[model samples]
Target: MTGVPASAAGGTGAKRVPAPKGKLGAAAVNQASLWNIANILTMVRLVLVPAFVVLLFQDGGYDPAWRAWAWAAFAVAMITDVFDGHLARTYNLVTDFGKIADPIADKAIMAAGLISLSVLGDLPWWVTSVILVREIGITLMRFWVIRLAVIPASRGGKAKTLAQGVAVGMYVLALTGPLATLRFWVMALAVVLTVLTGLDYVRDAVVIRRRAIVALRVAEAEAGAVEDSGASGDSASDEAGESAAAESTR
Candidate 1:
């Protein structure tokens, strides 16, 4: 009783309504603000994507100065990605705009950097295409089940994103000696992680859709049962009234 609500004090038979969770929480998030700090950071990240590409392809060659600056811009964008998400969650500022825009920014940045890498012939075109398909496909799946379920970024997904960034960053810097060889293996590992995480997301989406469907059916069934009970009670009252009238007439 120290901090409980008044309704819970005396067993007065009043039902206290609780806040909704699960998919209902997703609905609430979808309806929230797009004007928050988190969303602003995400928008900034989107804008930086093309800027990174431009700096990357400048002078038509791997000029050291241009490559260094390109890597710096990419690094800043990724840093914003980390901060925006942390600030949003810590401050309860999760919004649908952030949800959709954040992932788009993430994938777009990777696509921009990786595509630039392949175009410059530092990385293979086939690797770029595979990573692009996986990223785009998973992102699309996220939106497909967005309203029904807000899937928080998984740890494996985060690791995959980090691997992508590290691999791309190392390549962007045009590292020499052992580090260049290391970057190749890292890029390979990122590709494997990308495919694995994509499959995990597909499995998650299916489970979420099933759960939402089951919840909907349960809600409908409860409403129907309540209506039938009310109808039965009304019929009983009518019959009792008729019996009482017959007795009075006799």
Candidate 2:
């Protein structure tokens, strides 16, 4: 950075020659291809979201056959969500596109499932509303702090997601007998985890945001000190040059 040409920094309407490998710039260099297998699977999940919704509503929405097929489609979408993340991490195939689209796909699919259930009388309206607020709020929080901090998903959050999928899946099946009790318990746990994890995420975001602001201030102060040191050095050099010239003239 120190040796970089001043001309490069102060160029006036002049196009600078870019490095050969920097055709798309430095950030793009590290970005993975959008068409990777992980991303494709994510897109497939998005497609299946609407499929799941349509299947859930088919034939007046109460038909046993329709519910069976709907559950199967939803199950497939959930399965893909598990693999897409694994594949992305394992293959280092994560891209900017994936980072954005993947979450949107996830939230969209989950929202469709929860909303559909509420609409079909399988879930209480208040439960759906609570979960939806948490889901949407946390998602917004992520983007809000994206520039200053990163809040990775916690184990509780992941468990909550799994719980939701399982609970919703069971409800779609309209299961009978002893399994109904099991479903009720699972759904209860899912709701509890959902609320808890939502609170946890909010707390984490607040802490991270505060720390980030502190870090930024420290960085700025250090930069200012560096600039001051550089300015002092230049002033000393100029004074030395002037003193020598005056002595020679005397």
Best by TM-score: 2
Q: Residue-wise lDDT of candidate 1 within 1-250, one digit each (tens)?
A: 3896656764466676777787556446644767777889999999999899989888884888899999999999999999998878766778777867887898889888988899899999998998899887877887898878877789999999999999999999968999989998999999999889989989999999889989989999999999999999999999999999999999
Clashing pairs in 1: none
C-alpha lDDT of all candidate models, in order: 0.87, 0.87
lDDT, candidate 1, at 199: 90
Screening candidate 2 with a backbone cut-off below 3 angstroms (N, C-alpha, C), the clashing residue pairs are: none
Scored by lDDT, model 2 comes in at 0.87
